[model samples]
Target chain A: MQMDLVFVGWNHRVASLDLREKLSFTPERAREAMEGLFREKILTEGAVVSTCNRAEIYGLTDLDDSFEALASYFSRFHDVDGSVLRESALSGRGDVTVRHLFRVASGLDSMVLGEAQILGQIRDAHRRATEAGTARTVTHRLFQAALECGKKVRTRTALGTRPTSVPGIALSLVGRIFEEVADCRVLLLGAGETVELTARLLADDGVTRMSFCNRTQEKAAALAAEFGGTVVPWEERIPAFAAADVVLTATGATDPVIPGPEAKRALSKARRRGPLLVLDMAVPRDVDPAVEDVADVYRYDLDAFGELARANAAERQAEVPLAEAIVEESVEKFAAWLASLSMTEVVKQLRFKLEAIRRDELARSEPRLARLDPADREMVERLTEALLNKILHNPTVGLKHGDASQRLELAAAVRTLFKLDGEGRE
Target chain B: MASPSSPGLTNALLGVLALAAYALASVFYTAYLRHPRLKAGRLATGLAVLGAALNFSFLYARSLALKNVPYADLLGSMALFGFFLAGMNLVLEVRHHDRSLGPFLMPVSLLFLLLAFVLPAGGEKRPNLKGAIFAFHVTLNMLSYAAFAVAAALSGLYLVLGKKLKHRSKNVLAGPTARLPSLGYLERAARTSLGVGVVTLAAGLSMGFAWGYHVWRVDHPFWLLDAKIWGAGLTLLFYFVVLVRAHRGAAPVTTARLCIAGFVLVLLSYTAVNLFFSRIHSFT
Candidate 1:
């Protein structure tokens, strides 16, 4: 049987943002559509990977018309013009499709190169397909290997270590300064978007003891309520700052909010054991630059963070070749696994054929051997079994390790030499 | 019972096998340094474990051939040192779930094995020092040396990473840097190794004194003034000072420097005194 693996999709690179949004599917809808294709026999095995930036259907099919059928069904289900859908999306088959899935799972095909979220997205897609009863041996192996490739790319290369966004830069900085973020108390000094975003990142990094301060108390309160935290008043900022493990400043103030002397005096009063990590994200510089002179205080302004992001991005970009090599290696491995499936089938038949011959010869020769002692007859039986095993060992090993055409030719020869049918039965 | 070859031949074969295994592990570890993968780490650990096992076998076979514990010889002791280093690193890798130190550690292990190749397989034809106390002293002393070796390697790593962080070097947090455990973890490992080293060395030295008092009589305890004894004493005291500094919350860099200096002292005690100076303990 020929298993044609295919992927049909549009991603952020190929499609407009509006088109990608229009083509996206809810998890439930994606699963339902995948099950529908499996039910219709257009896809023998299928999974739908849908996100805000991309929507893809990966499936195994035996029919030549599978891709066209999948494309038509996609357009009809979403009520899009067939020509427009074709123009916006691309479909690939065979190894090309397999390579694409590997790259996608490895984050090489993400909107941001080496973004981590796509791995989870692909895993969820596999889980959904498994639940929908639309995944089988080929697609399951492909998806599992893709996930493994994704993890290998992430851990083996430096692809995912670089921060691609501002919030990511902040977290990377925090990771550099502190070994563990769970015990850190965060002091957010503004209620603007950057502060809110950084707070969310910090919370994700396990920063629980968080308090926000703003010129407008209501904004601070609103932001604090969103993060399940309390608000700190402007007057109480010094005490909060001193108590905080990390202080993030992103305010619209034109002047320095936390002066050098004030920070030093607050730090001296607090008498903290660990270093204080300060991120000054404000454009006009909310934290005074001279605060860096204080003991046990590491400060980074916007320019420093920008520099970190740029350097890390360059590092990550340089790792793309390594990640791609991993992807290519995974694709070849998957192909080998697929080929081995056919080899397994061939070997099974060959074993059946050889066993039949052994049984026939044993039936014919047992009576003469039976005249000896029962133990002697049993010895003869063992002798012939060993002989068969030795005879079949080399060819079976060869077939299992052989390429497709070699396997086919050797399988045909084995059948013909034994006068067995293609099924390896007499 | 028939044997394929002499016990000496068998021991030499096992040594060659162990060297090959350790070299293979070193290659894998070095590869893992550039490409941090669980597979490479697992393979390196497996090979290191294999090498340690073969190394132990070689030591046992050599002891059987010589009709004594192998510690009397420089070659045997160095082989034991390599085994202990790999074995300790395997334990640390399992305990801390960290593999970044392997690339840095395997070379030291390989160096010891290479030394084993050149040193005479048997020590000088001295009578076997009686008493289990003698055995305990040598074993514990060798074990302490292994612990200090690990401490020194981790301290060196601490310094390199500290330098990178101090200067904010480009790509400091990428590639091999990403593979390294936090400086906190390295420091903890170094401190733990130092603690173990100090305790073992103290017990070992005490056992040595007791063994000497029994063997040579209390009136003839001139080995106490020997270069090896002084070297071992100062090495123990040096690591003890590092332990105290660590307890007092000395900076990681300072503790690292102290551990390094302690290892240097250990090197002097293990090598220089044995080769260059005459002493009652010059059995190797």
Candidate 2:
């Protein structure tokens, strides 16, 4: 097998979001890039994966010269210098490469750890490569194994359970205090994408009643209409907070919009009948961090949300060893099957050599048997064939039952003892 | 010639095998939670399967010896229910690749299996028609209970892990636990199980009513005022409420709590009717 594998990519470990944004490839751009790589004759088989956290180029190539060529291709395609691309690139060969791909697919190497979305992302990459006519038997098997490893890890472990995202976190918190979301009311303090996403998450969890109060009333009304929530005027945001059981703030304000005093006043108005979950996803802090100290007000800042996400990411990382063990076991099982192919050739050669020896001996004895009856000669030939069969049976059985290491040792012994090849004597 | 009606040997073997398997599976699952090796998990699953098979054989032999369905007696019913739960757990584990559920599921299975050994094994066989209806009721009820068990476990996990994720904690256990299916999936599962429980309860109750009316006049009945019947009716109502709330899109955590409570009621009804109360249905 020609062992050639290359991973040209950027991820959370090697690059910041700013760098990733510049390097990220849209599906259309990825397709164009793959085609470009093919035109440059840098690789025979290739796939591209682009996600919020990662953008990777996986390919198989034979020429030693092609590695540099492929690295330079990534730089030119992403409008970056060769040195910048090289710093983030990872390359491996043979088993290491196979293991790496399996780990990635299994979510052992994911930014979020155990996220299920990456498996679909990998499948999409493989599908696109096949569509581009770049995926051959080797790449196909490699990708298929990776997908299987991902599935096995998911089913056999608890690594993929629970939401790790900010939106997911906010909804889960709201779920805890309320028996059901239908009875709970929500107040959203922004009209940005983060708030919209959080609203969608909460809606999915059965939080039907909500109020959106943004700096702009039009933006609030528009967002509220999509989710069937009412829009509150910005001036009455604190009073709106009193009506809500949960508050999520993700505004673009330079300072805290919902101060600690305002939060405390709202909490007192509700008479602490229910807790208020506040999610502050703004960079500059939409809600004062001190609001968390208020009784019955659970406020989480961006850092806290990020820590939860990271902690969840770490928990998933812990499962990586177990997931890798499964992948390793699978790879060994597959390699044994591959090794068995060599046994077929060995068996064929042994039979051919044995048959040649039998024929030579028969030829020498032909003149002596010519004087005997035809029936007697036929009996001698049958006896000779049976003796040869008996001798070969034990080795053949051993080869079938044994793994690659055992088979290799046995094959070596057979070749050396029989001197089947003249080079064995040397 | 000796009589062939004794299941002494078969019952003993089954009891031993079931207990051993239950213990082994529980340990393996616990180890799997800690180490999470596929080898350990696969071993646990295999033992569970073997245990189920042995339990099935025991039930068959017992049924043959008694010349009636094995579920007729309290012990036999408990054993049958245990087998059903164990079988369901294995299937779910295999299907979802979720072994975290084992610690929760195996104890329930083992408890039933142990109860099976303690209760009397032989009972008076009812008529064939009544026996068929009895079997139908018990089987469906057991299946519904199994589904509810799963829903309860998933919901419990969701409540804890969901809370941790929300607070943005760094707890490893909270992070690695599989994301509970969207609240929608859990609610749907809970509703479906509740619906099945209700339907099964209705069928069972209706059959009891028909049988009671036949034995007595319209105004007076032999088993009309049985505690088992009332308990079952109440349990059905509980699930009815759960189903309604779920249909209206209840939060998964809330629905899960209801499901857990409903299942607990089911267990109480099943136990009280079979073990403590005497009624026309208590042929055991």
Candidate 3:
């Protein structure tokens, strides 16, 4: 009833990899440590989410120093100086704790913004704590609600819709240029690793017809065989520009493979009506910069593509307010549920007191009641239980349904009237 | 008959209610497009459908009072045109499973309904010709015009979206361009609407000519000189060419531009020709 939430964590934004690795907990070790935490009485409930990018400890505590104790516990368990833990990471209290966990679970606070893996990590952490018997009502509900919030944010907002990685950026660029990737013919130059990775991603995004061109035709043939495409001879790679709707070049050649003038002449000769999107992904740039000046030919080199990635990140950032709104809604809901826990305690105690009285009255009247048949006696027991439930029904409903502040008043009144637990229990 | 206590029971009140619904739907759809998190798209679709229903009620009231198809007058035809627009858009929106076009398309119907209000009521002109053929001709033409209106809306959006995509604009959330369909989708949808418009216009124009052959004398001095007749012929020709080009998979931008031009011809045919200088036609 007197629980308060606290969080102690360090992420890539604040701590170096060395510190994060030092502070991280394995699943088996986390459970063992959480049981020790229960014995130490620092937290009533706790969960530890330890991943490559972050190590977070979430808990319900009643002591004023539980946050400090968590920091100290981390240093002691990991054999680091307590001051180093304090200096590198900070703790969040109550609402801040809830908000931090929600943001992390929703992928808003991830190293790669809007990455979807954090939600599963949080779920696993909560599960481990539950299996360890260290996660009770509040910890379980908080994580469950956070997971729901994470899902809603993913679905209802387009925060995670933008691509951030290199292959993802290539997919997004293709999507923006071509309305239907399934209909476009993709030409992947240089059967290198970058091109292979991009080809696989593009294939998954519905690029069916692919043509691979490499100086080493065998490498091109191998990649084409793997991704179900044909390999064009290296001599015919320039003419292949006229045939391709999209051209992605990532060759390690020290020079431009498709020169701007040659591409312009070839594209002009073909008189292609639609756009020719060329992504020059090589370090030295596979396609010459002048190809962009050609009419209806859109070209972006590696740096220009990085600009696209940055712009995509900015767009994802713009959706933060929307994601934050969802997180805010979940936090308010958790707060209300937490407040209702107090009322729940009153209801539990009131029922316990009523049941005790019921048993005592039945015991005191045992001789008189023992004269009834076994069936009648059983019916009497059921009747008393039903009567007790009926008496509790309205007050319980009234306590649960109203606003939190009003419910607090009703809970207080119930506590005082029932005289079960006084205000001193507050 | 709907009772007077009902909101849109009276013809005048029905026009007002339908117009109001269309107006609110426009705002909601626009809001939904700009900020999809607002969750206004469904409500906007519902309002548009309600507006269409009210427009149908208006037509039903006119039909009940006059025992006709309710397109005999300028006002009645305008209301019917708006009704068909909303009706066809609802069909397309549901069919495509994309509600983003509502904001762009609803205002056309709203404009027609507003024009209906400013004009005289249905009783101003009773049915001049009362045969099934004549009714089919008028109704088909109105429905064809409605389809063209939808095609025009989709084409306009296609042009804007295609331009934004071609330019590779990152401001996907800015202005009215947000939530616009992909260029391919818009092109395909516009072509579909244009195709329906052409087929319906072909049928309706044929019916008109057949009925006119019986109704109006072929040897009349000014029969071929009717501005509406020339307008209809020109619009049909231009749109038929656009449809052919689109069917052949022309560049989407060219197809979008041609569809837009075709809609311009349709507007001229529907408005300038219908309202002003058509000697043999006085349709609005």
lDDT digits (tens) for residues B61-164 of candidate 1: 87788677776667777888898899998998898787778887777887887786775443346664645898789889999999999999998987786666
Provide the DockQ value for model 3: 0.22
In model 1, residue pairs whose N, Cα or C atoms come closer than 3 Å (at least 3 residues apart or on different chains), thus clashing, are none
Q: Candidate 2 - CAPRI tier?
A: incorrect
Pitting candidate 1 against candidate 2, the one with the higher lDDT is 1
lDDT of 1 by residue, A269-354 (tens): 77454456788899899998776666446677877776777788788889999999999999998886555446556577667877
Which candidate model has the greater TM-score, 1 or 2? 1
> What is candidate 1's CA lDDT for residue B261?
86
User: Highest lDDT: which candidate?
Assistant: 1
| Model 1 chain A: lowest-lDDT 10 consecutive positions | A400-409
Best candidate (score: TM-score): 3
| Predicted complexes: DockQ each | 0.16, 0.10, 0.22
CAPRI quality of model 1: incorrect
lDDT of 3 by residue, B1-284 (tens): 22221224477677788899999988888788777745588889989999999889888877777676676666677888999988887898898787788887788789888877675332224235668888888898898888888888887887776556445565433334545666556766778888898998989999888777777765455666778888998888888988897676466677777777787887778777777787667652
Local accuracy of candidate 3 as per-residue lDDT tens digits, A61-118? 7677776898888788889889888888857888899999999989999998888778
TM-score of each: 0.69, 0.56, 0.78
Model 1 bad stretches (over 4 Å): A1-10, A18-50, A55-106, A122-163, A169-191, A205-426, B1-17, B37-40, B65-68, B73-76, B116-129, B212-230, B273-284
